[model samples]
Target: MRDAEISSWRQWVTGLMVAGLVIGTAGGPLVGQETDDAEEGPQQVIIERTPVQLRDPKTYSVSLSLEPIREIDLVAVADGVTGAVQVQLGGAASRQAEAVRLDSAERQLELERAKALFRVAQAEQRATSGGDANAVEAAEGRLEAARAELRLAEHRLDATVVRFPFDGKVMGVHVVPGQFVRAGQPLVTLADTSKMRVAIPVDRTAVNEGDTVDIKIETDTVQAKVETIVPLKAEFEPLRELFVSVATAVLVLENGDGKLKAGQTVFADMIPRQPVMEVPTSTLANMEEGGRKVQVIRDGFVRDIPVKLLGQVGEEHVFVSGRFSAADELVLSSSEVLLDGARAVPAGAEIPTEEDEGAGPAGRRRGSRF
Candidate 1:
């Protein structure tokens, strides 16, 4: 019975071993299938980034104009050409003395006698050699004095008519024809507005002495050449405290229409082009760190690049300089999801810095917010 039992145990043990080998062989396909599924796992989708070239918006402002104003200078003496006043202007110095007269006709006769005596002295010197050189010199001196007196009389007679000094307009007429005016009296004041000038404030860096600017007066566009760029004085009211100052620039422009009057406020915009690095307004972003910045996409990761902004252009943004290239991808819109190392989709399936035109990339589409 022991022998039989041993033989049966050996047969059953052999049968169990065979069954285990078949079962292990059958499980190989399931293990291979599980390995394949793990290798091909679900993929994550990301947004896209792109680079573009657009016109730069860097603005340099200068004032339209600061003009020179002229007031009238009145003629002080108007002796002749009185009354029948046609409201004219002349140089004050050219006018004869007003209310000036020779004191007496007897005084004139005394002058005449002095002249006769001088002539007699001349003849006496010729006739007798009484060391008359002194007498002759004295006579000549006396004759000159008489002639001066006559000239004074003549000036008094001619002082009645007034003449114009230069081309100017008369502001007012004080007296009519036959109006007797005294010396040092007021005739009419005159003003000169023939040559008009303007003063405009500008950035010291934007303009130099010879820079030309396009100026517009209402509808008229004119080219105004810079005559001077002078440092504004400390006496200026508003600019007194500002250390970075507004400079005075003188420009010569056409005022033919005379539309631009003195003291009239002018609104103007200036576009000056200097060499500066520029990026599209959309390329820049506001940072949480309290300053402006840009998104720098590199190696399929996002980077926040710091930037310094200068000003703006027509519906565009402005910056002085930056390290980014035109081919670098930037995020246009705001997103809390964007950060350093964030995964991004590109415009094209071919992942490169630059995107080819008119093709759909991995995640970029027209409907998606930029």
Candidate 2:
């Protein structure tokens, strides 16, 4: 029963195929009368005008961003017991406050001794000071020393407290309260996620200095200009010349409402010198037997145009053909049963809508495997 239905469909298309030939020859000078009918007519899929692309669209890329660029490390300046950690909202103490607090007790005694010596030097008589200039020297020296000692004592006392250097969240807490810490020990690690960067592995063969590139992280798309192409050679992959393949480029990222994250995997939309076309694989269509073809609808006729397949492009076949234009009309097959040069009517043609696709901007139809 299915076979009979198939035969009947074929018979109907055969009749339509003959009608299409007659319709095509109506305006032009008739030549089919003399031409051999044995030659298969141009398979009817759809007739479309190839778009005249000025600058063909292209997509190429390097690595988006791999890691954040601004990362900082916090370390303890001096060693001591952890004390008051700027527990107030206002001015916080310094990082080495713990060390200062530990030595504050001894500093107070030294400050007192310095003050007494300063007083003794100031009491020297002018006559004695003039006759013995050494007295003046001793007084000034002692006074300076006393002032320094006082400052030291104050600093030591202040060391017991820790304060924030800048407004930021605590990334980590290494030593807790009452925990003994040593000098130069790591306290917390901080990373500025305000803006991220992508390290792109550039191909010296494909990229040059100062070439702009695009990176797409999920739905977010951003542009990155050429900062610097770092020329590096590895022991595993040595450079054949002074500069080998694979350069590192710092790609500045646009936060775009902070949608992008550090260490997130993203694809780079690297623009190449060569223009390229981005089309869906479904847009690539193969005819009954005349290789691959795409249906182009123009002037109310769907004509099958030949397309040269150019391998796979993200699971879609990229076709190279002179018939395809950026603004040409792409006719999706009518119920997947359309034939070459099939007579078709555009839907909603005379509706007088605000927007019009006309003969261009219609997407393509990928052919099914016969």
Candidate 3:
């Protein structure tokens, strides 16, 4: 019985194989032809493209604090008690204006005595004009000594008043009326606010002196010019490690209206020094080895073009430089995998409107057949 069962199973399998061969001979060619047709047909990808545009270099923003163009601490030149305070804290001090006056009664008396002694010396020198040569020489020496003493007295008297060296704002006052202050002690802190200074960190290759930039403070925006550039020191080695050519840019902004103040937060927009090409940020792709690339339609086929990313213009756009030209059409979006040299059809070739450009990543999607 087992032999019979095995023999029957063999016969059934042989019959099924013969039947399958017959069907394949009649219908398999149709299925194979359909697959061959599909393989030979041109791939249909719903790709979105835009013409590459030449745009101004991207602007990089950096936060900074405003500082006075010039600041100094006015110190006491002589030991004296503050007799009067002419300028109050936060008040404007004019050039050559007296800011403080020390008690000068003693200084006044010393000045008077020096004047009297000078007059006496002059009279004695005149008297000795016809005397012996030795007596005349001694009188002349005495007159010279008196003149020197008078000049010293005058200088000491002048030291009693603290005068503003330049037009500025008094930021601090350390001495009040009747307060005794020693020589070299700080009396007032003054800052020249007619122009504001700010130090901005940026890529040295992208920024240069004399370049004008926009600075934002609170809600207001003002223009500032790059005054100088300073290389980073060893202390900024970490920053240098991150950005090899990192440096500080000194910028100056006019504040004649006194609207800008020191220590206020400011945002400086640093524009790139070189011109660059602009494209949508979503179009950038990463290579397996390294670096970035963008797809462009060339000869009706997808071509990969390597680009150097200079900076970002906005959330959706980027500045780049490479071998591509403004006439090239950049692949903004594609529904299928874009392989190098793969034939593709751009379904939307018209330039995207501003509203469409801002429609987020979803707007890049479209129905496609591959």
Q: How much lDDT does each candidate structure score?
A: 0.47, 0.47, 0.70
Q: Model 3 lDDT vs. the true structure? A: 0.70
The list of candidate 2 runs beyond 4 A from truth reads 1-66, 85-131, 155-169, 205-211, 233-244, 267-370
Task: Report the C-alpha lDDT of model 1 over 1-370, residue by residue, as the tens digit.
Answer: 1459647744754553333210001112211124455443212233334453323333233344435344443443433335345443333222322322212344456556656765665565565555668776776665666667666655544444444454444545566566565656666655343444556656677778888887565466666778898876433323322214457777765445555444444434322233234455776768776767777554344567666654454355454344555556555443234544443443233332224423544223312212
Please give each candidate's TM-score. Answer: 0.39, 0.44, 0.58
lDDT for model 1 comes to 0.47
Q: Give candidate 1's root-mean-square deviation (CA, Å).
A: 24.4
List per-candidate RMSD values in Å: 24.4, 15.5, 17.7
lDDT at position 31, candidate 1? 16
- Rank list by TM-score: 3, 2, 1
Candidate 1 minimal-lDDT segment of 10 residues:
21-30
lDDT of 3 at 214: 76
In terms of lDDT, the best-performing candidate is 3
Displacement of residue 330 (Cα, Å) in model 1 is 24
